[model samples]
Target: MTVILKKVPESEKYILRNFCSLYLHELSNFTMNLDVGEDGIFHYVELDNFWTVDGLSPYFIQLGGDIIGFILLLERPFLNKSNDYGINDFFILNKYKGKGLAFQAVEKLFKEKQGQYFVIQVAENRRAIAFWKKVYNRLNIETHERQDIIDDELCLIQTFKI
Candidate 1:
C-alpha cells in the first residue's frame, strides 16, 4: 500500500502544530531539548516558518485519508548545509512502526526530490540511527555517516545522493 504525502494547507496549520507537539515530546526522550511551556504545551518556534519561509515544506503522511504522521522538508537545512535537501522532522505514530510505512514515506519523498539529501539524529538516538540504516539498505542507496555538533549538541549526520 502506498502512503500518500499531502501538502499541508494553511487552513490546516493548527493540525500540524498539534502533531509537532507530540513529535517533540517523543524526541524529548532522546535529546532532552524540548519542554512544555507555561501554557502546558510544547511550542515549536519554527513551525510557522514553513508557511512564510522559502525552501520549506510541510506534508501530512496519509494512509487512505487517515493522517498518521507528518514530515517537514527542507531545501537548505539549518543544521547541515552541504546537502541539497534535508528532513527537518519526520514522524510516524508508534502504532504505525514496523509496518514499512516509514520506509515507503521516505522512499517517496526522496524520489520526488531526488538530489543530495541528508538526515540528522541526536547522537544518543540509537533506534533512529538503526532505522535510517535500514531505510538506506532497503533503498540500496550509498550513504556517508559522520558526527558533528549541531546547536551545541552532538549529532549523527547521514548524507546520500539519490
Candidate 2:
C-alpha cells in the first residue's frame, strides 16, 4: 500500500518512455480523438530534454516495488504568480484504477511539493473532472476553477494554493 513518486533516473529512460506510451494510450480514450500513432507509440520528442529543463520533472508512481504509473510536473509560475506548479501529466494503469491508489499518490505528491498548483482535465472527460473534485475535497483545500481552450481543446482548469 506504499505509494511513492520516484524521480525517473537517466539510466531508466526506457522505463519512462514505455510508461509515457501507456499514459498517452489511456488518455486518448478521453482526449479529443488523439492518434496513438501507427506503431501504437506516443513519441514525445521533448522527453530527452526533461533532465535539462529547469522546472520540468518526470516521476514514476511506484506502488510497493512495481512501477504502476507516472506524473510529469512543471514548476513554472502561473499568471505571473510565483511558485505555481502544474501537474502536466498523471496516469495510473488501468489494472490499478478504482483502488484509491491515485489519491494516495497525489496526496503525497502535493504534500512534498506544496505551493500554488494547477491541474487540468479535458472537458470531455467527465470521470476525470469528478475524480479531481473528489481529490480536492478530500484535501480540504479551496480551489478556483475555470475553463480554457488549450491546444485547440477546452480544458477544465483547477487552481489551488496548498
Best by TM-score: 1
Error of 1 at 75 (Å): 1.2
Q: What tens-digit string does per-residue lDDT give for candidate 1 at 131-154?
A: 999999888989998999997778
Cα lDDT for residue 56, model 2? 85
Ten contiguous residues minimizing lDDT sum, candidate 1: 75-84
lDDT of 2 by residue, 74-106 (tens): 885323455468888888998998899999889
Off by over 4 Å in 1: 76-81
Those runs of model 2 whose alpha carbons end farther than 4 Å from true positions after fitting are 76-83
| CA RMSD of all predictions | 1.9, 1.9
Error of 2 at 61 (Å): 0.7
Task: Please state the error at residue 109 of candidate 1 in Å.
Answer: 0.7
* Candidate 1 TM-score versus the reference: 0.93
The local distance difference test score of model 2 is 0.85
Candidate 2: residue 4 lDDT (0-100):
92
TM-score of each: 0.93, 0.91
